[model samples]
Target: MFKGNFIQNLPKIYGTYTGGFLAFIILMAIAENAGVSKETIGILFVAFTVCIYAIIGYLSRTVQVDAYYVAGRQVPTVFNGMATAADWMSGASFVAMAGGIYFGGYTYMAFLIGWTGGYVLVSSLLAPYLRKFGCYTVPDFIGTRYGGNLARFCAVVVLALASFTYVTAQINATGTIASRALQIPFELGVWVGLVSILLCSMLGGMRAVTWTQVAQYIVLIIAYLIPVFWISSSGNYGIFPHLMLGDEVAKLGELEATFGLKENSKEAMAAMTFADGSPVKGLKYIVNSHAGVPDGAMAAWKFISLVICMMVGTASLPHILMRYFTTPSVKAARKSVAWSLFFIALLYTSAPMLATVSKLSLMDPSLATGIIGKSIAEVQSIDWYQAWNAQKWMHIQDFDNDGKLALNEFFMRGDIVVLATPEIAGLPYVISGLVAAGGMAAAMSTADGLILAIANALSHDIYFKIIDPKADVRKRLLVARALLVVIGAAGAFVASMKLTSILGAVAWAFDFAMSGLFFPLVLGVWWKRATRQGAIAGMIAGLGSGTIYLYMVKFAENANENIILGIDHLRFGIIGASVCFVVMVVVSLMTPEPDKATQDMIDEVRVPSGKTVLGKQH
Candidate 1:
């Protein structure tokens, strides 16, 4: 599908992508400076992003099997890197990360460390080998390497489970960002997002998703960086927020103290009035409120557990790993991972910094003084309060009879940190719109990858491989497209349920992936002795144990009192992954070794450069 100079053309493509983004920014800035209404500009910003990505999807549309499955296995290293970054970033990294950092504080660094460091596993242990294996999907690698219909079916089940969970979160993020940005109902927003995802993914599969993600990465990175840069410059931190976040952190602590914002204290827990004038308890931002561990060592243990889960989960996620399969070669896969980390690190390092700055700005004495002594009516009249209040993301009530806004009177959801940062920092509404559009890009990009992963697993692994082995390219492509719509709709419906925060849902999906797929996938490539029986058993044990434990602790009887060894449900992936690893090792030792043919296949994949079978076209 592609010949020489594919890599050389990537820089020009990126330049064009950057130029398009800049043009959008300039257009939005012009409208903003011309005094266009913020609401109008925000809607236009979101609409423009969706429409442009849809255009990219249309242009990249392909009916060929190679293009649909792995973008013809010809994506260049740098563009592949950008696409992987976009796929990896997701709504969690773009929208919810700063929010997580804002509420979770120091402990939230786990997400940063886990997600970024996971690429190390990808480069060193996963990507190169998988690319060399020359498979269309993660399950393909498993089925081909291990042999047997049972192995292929089991891999499909795990892939579907993990990808479904992951796609739901990404869709949820899409709805969250769209609802807030477009001023639409969340239910409607979710459907809107579903349409956008289908537009991109249903057209060209991996090919469309790849190009769209590259475009999305540009939008998201710029959207994330601009606000951080603005906030830093505004706070006199110069352009480098990471280097000077210490002062802001200290200032935030001081401001919290001055406002009498003690953790779990009555002052911080003062009851507040809802928009309808009904009274309810105020929200708590205390770190220990949901920590489930009071002691430092226990908290550290929980944090480390989550970090391990995220790291392994990132490496385990099918959509993320699927990106490597699109690259031209094993060496390109390795190089792409390095570039992915470089692109991702730009946002990863800045998230905590933005979180710190946002907290300081929110808790600043000046804003506190302006609101502290104000009536409910007066607080409602405030711009930031009114804007966010309209979305019900923020609520304030004068708890005391003194008719003054106290620290307890102010309540905002964690999600507001990123959404409201531009407004909070006095940036123009255009910047806010751009940020919102950026969030959409992040959500849509990840959703594209996830939907493609699930669709491929179903259409390729299950339907074409087992249900209809005689199916041709046309039939296979249609099956994938049809399944994509079904899966996309299901994701949107689940997302509309609003089960949890963006980060929480994403973490759970990560946990599921790590639990079910991590051990089998990793060992399948690295361990020649890893048998089919072992892979199947390991997946079942890991998924079953993790699911049961999470249910017991999160939704079962006496769930609140059911923490295992002081471990939270979010950190349950470590338990699952551990069980899978042990089970795989034990089962492999007990079972017959893999055949000589399988060993030869493994040896070939171990190499970094080679032509290998991909499909009939190859």
Candidate 2:
């Protein structure tokens, strides 16, 4: 028993997917009685997963050094796109966004658009230039640009805050998916996942996490796509990626005869208390849109915020920028971004369609009512509500004072979309197990990367770079390992709290990066006259504006009616980005640019090797 417990604590490290695959085995055993077919597709998915991890680990041995931090600066544009796809498609994509789309209607597309388009901005505006700088972290760029240690220190703080917040949130998302899909305790789910992240991250730094991400990318995309295939094929139209409501409608009409749909689920109503002291009014929703959700996909300002966060945040992210360093040249960096985007688009474009189709099916009367519903219930009774009741999550309330279940309340959560897919489309039990493991993979991939980044920044950027430049690389790496332990422990504690609003936390992180660094980096590269004063002022304004707004939304106990304005954390980041850009321009106009050496460096970053730029090249 002791050995088993210890081994579980330190997940086996063999294949590239050691942690995730083992967890997959554990999930399969638990799901053995989930009433799924438990055959062919499951074996195929598991085999694909193992191969993915092996390929990544085998190749990553070639990835070493500070250059590896930037992906050797040799990564082709296409691979970079694939890598970036892996980077951005974290736990959020694996679970949350699709669910949000299902629940929020077309409005959720605004978030997707923002996330996807942001990469375009990053690749075009910032990623290539930063790659040329040969910097290890975001603060490295700031330190050199400002010629001030203070600026570098500040960047570290913001980076730590933004990243840890995002990491913790991803773990929470993993727990949410596991709890719903496997009926596991949320805290146990988080701990089981976090251990995997710690092992890989603590081993090879960014090198380990990068390879792991590649493995996770395959699993995540597979888990997502397979279910869509099942659902589409199960429908009548034979239209792939297209929904046919014919079967669903017929099914629903029958269910309505008994266990009728309540006007609005009481569970959903209980979740809201409006300004007028009345419950938010709306009909109950089964798959995605529950009562009291934002009426549209997104508002205009919200849209703007999403774009800025996704685009700017990706470009400046320390770990992502770290990948470019692994590439061999500026051209490679450019090419890599293209590949990452292509791979990412595979699932991103499909997400909305999947959400829409999923909502239609889950809410179909036949499935939600009599016989089919009874079958779903029988399948669900294995571990039963007894295990779930202790978790105190997934409430089922009777609305209209009726004795029957509301069922609609489950749809409102953002992670439920993927968790319900295998079961809903009538796929095998192994798919459910695979998805649960996949969720862990997504969470671990991001969590370990973030943790390692925090550790590396402390040892490499601060202790070694600034405080003690003479420190040996090995010792520096050791220091980094120590920090990883701290970060992992902290993230686990935060995840165990069962904190909701992961999407909100992620937005705050993007805002922090955008508000504080976007303008400084943007102007530093483009404007020869961008002085230290301008960068400082712009950063302050951007970060300050965003921070105040976040406090109002997340912390303030009693808030104003402006809450109805729909300005979330993402919107706040955009406002802050604007302020920073304006302040930088105004200050630059009042002062002179960096000296000739700095200006020359800027010119150098813009020109790719073997290409002549008129009289440029410093």
Q: Looking at candidate 1, what is the lDDT of residue 348?
A: 90
Candidate no. 2 TM-score: 0.78
What C-alpha lDDT do the candidate models reach, one value each? 0.82, 0.62
Candidate 2: tens digits of C-alpha lDDT, residues 142-255:
777666766677667767877887888876765555455444577886775565566555555666566567667666776677677766666542466644544543444454
lDDT (Cα) of model 1: 0.82
Per-residue CA lDDT of candidate 1, range 404-426, in tens?
66665567777677888888778
Q: Native-vs-model 2 lDDT?
A: 0.62
Candidate 1 — worst ten consecutive residues by lDDT sum? 284-293
Error of 1 at 521 (Å): 1.2
Runs in model 1 deviating more than 4 A are 1-8, 265-272, 277-295, 366-380, 397-408, 613-618
